[model samples]
Target: MEWTLWFSYILLSFVVITLVHSLLLPNLSKIRRIEGVPLVSVLVPMRNEVRNVKGMVDSVKKQTYKHIEVFFLDDESTDGTSSALELAVRGDARFKVLQGKPKPEKWIGKVFACHQLSEAAKGDYLLFLDADVRIQPEAVERALGLMQQKNISLLSGFSRFILPTWLNKLLVPLQHFFVLFHLPILLANWTKWPPATAAHGGFMFFERSAYQAIGGHAVVKENIVEDVAISKRMKAEGYRMWIANITSVASCRMYETNAEVWQGFTKNIFNGIGRSIPLAVGIILFYGVVYVGSGILALAALLVEERVLLLPYLLIILQAGIVYLNTREPLALAFLLPVASVAFILLLVSAMRKSVKGQQVEWKGRYYG
Candidate 1:
């Protein structure tokens, strides 16, 4: 029991340190225009993104960097996505709408679209963006400047989530929390190791040469977690990849409601952990013991008049508070950390089970097996 308590404290201390380090990591500085603007192709692969296309185009039009061509690949959308793209780029010579071909065998939809977009892009730099993301006017400029300054080949930034619903508020922060707490951004940036690398799929900026050198999205064609896969690949190939908090420059409304959130996460959770059962189970157990277990033990201790057991619970709360602080989430929500942890574990398990059962994961009217 004493050994268990010590282990819990040690783990909690590590969590606290990682969270604190993440918060202290410097934010990407805003970039002012420099001479000779290079042409940047902002590649957006869309499938049933009619609702977001107009806003995305409008934001692109507002970019401070004028030397950019926008490519919207209409990935065989049955919805109004193609029409939306056509309307969004109606009079703009800088924007081009590409008709997406049928995806090749064993290729994921988005990755195939991205590969096609890359093939057609006529720019020195490629800025890959999801349709749901809205960028600030200087986002591209800042991102490019940061890449140049840091001497990085690929730069990925996590966008701020616009959480309108209760479930979104609870779950959306976990995305950033996971990256910040579990993977230290500073260490990742400094290291050449593949395990230390991470990237957000929503916003990735890459030098065209570097992107092509690593075979672009084609190398990660079938990977569901293509961003991380590509980042790891780039690192393995000795390319410099950097990730930063770009919340000030971009925001994404990833899911509108709880069901979407659940479905979306359920589809990616297993793949996110490399589809290793041991890793998945270990994560589940860790969360269960530290977050859920601590909460239950604290309550039980209160009832049974055992104050010593409450120490681990206090440590867990302290770790939760640190996570909330780093994530910039409301402190009150920290109390629900146990619930969130449990939900994450359940989602991961469900995803793994579905994978084992050969169930298809569906997204954007397409099925992936």
Candidate 2:
């Protein structure tokens, strides 16, 4: 029993060490700007985004670069999203609003929309963004600059969210923490290792040449988590892909309520890691035990005066504390990581149950497993 505890402590300590190193020596590559304006096409896929469609369309209309073309694909949205887009783009000559064709049997909705957008794109570079994202005035210009300076084929940025409610504050911050601590973008870029990446899918910039070389959406047509898959495929095919914290430049409200967050996450959470149940369950179980269990042991050690175990307990506490701090969550919610970890496990279990029955999860008022 003692050995098991010690072994767990050591394993978790390694993860902590990696995270700590990530914090102290975060190697963020500098963002560079292109010398002149580059012809860019921005593609947005929309479905039932009535509340947000107009604002997103307006945001693009306000871009600093005038050489950009905008394509807004309406994916059979029934909630008057099409009309809203029509009104938003009516006076703008650069903006073209097209209706998305029906999703084919083997293709995911987003991928199919993107594939169609690519066919209609008439620029040297393609920017794929979700309908909900609102970019700052210079977002596209800055992204193009960074792409040119870094010589990267793909550029992905993380966006900030409007936490209008307490539920948003509690859950959304944890997602950011996982992105920072568990999958630090700096480590992937600095070490010449394959970048384990996260993107706001809300905002992505891709070179047309790289998109073609890697086979574009056609390669990942069936994947629900096509963004990440596309990034990985791009890297594997020897194209440069860069990810950075672009939270300052753009923001979105992914969900407004707790139920919305659950449904939104469920749409792709299971398939994000893989559709395999055992793989998802094993990961949830392992992390829950290591992160949550270690904290439990540390608390008991303090209460029961287990002096011999004090060092390991302290190590666990320190590791978790550092991760919490880096996460930038409100101190109270951040400290409740054990609780959050448990919640994640429950969500994974829920996903597994649904996937087992071949059930499709709903998103944007449409169902996809």
Best by TM-score: 1
Q: For residues 83-103, could you state the per-residue lDDT of candidate 1 as single tens digits?
A: 878887999999999999999
Clashes of each: 0, 2
Instruction: Flag regions of model 2 displaced more than 4 Å.
Output: 1-31, 165-167, 184-187, 190-197, 294-332
Model 2 lDDT at residue 5 = 64
What C-alpha lDDT values do all the predictions have? 0.83, 0.74
Clashes of 2: 2
Q: What's model 2's TM-score?
A: 0.83
Model 1 segments beyond 4 Å from truth?
1-8, 32-35, 301-331
TM-scores of all predicted structures: 0.92, 0.83
lDDT tens string, model 2, 104-222?
88998889999999999998899998887888777887778877877878888656666666556655656556665567556444333455666557777899999999898999998
lDDT of 1: 0.83
* Clashing residue pairs in candidate 1 (N, C-alpha, C atoms within 3 angstroms): none
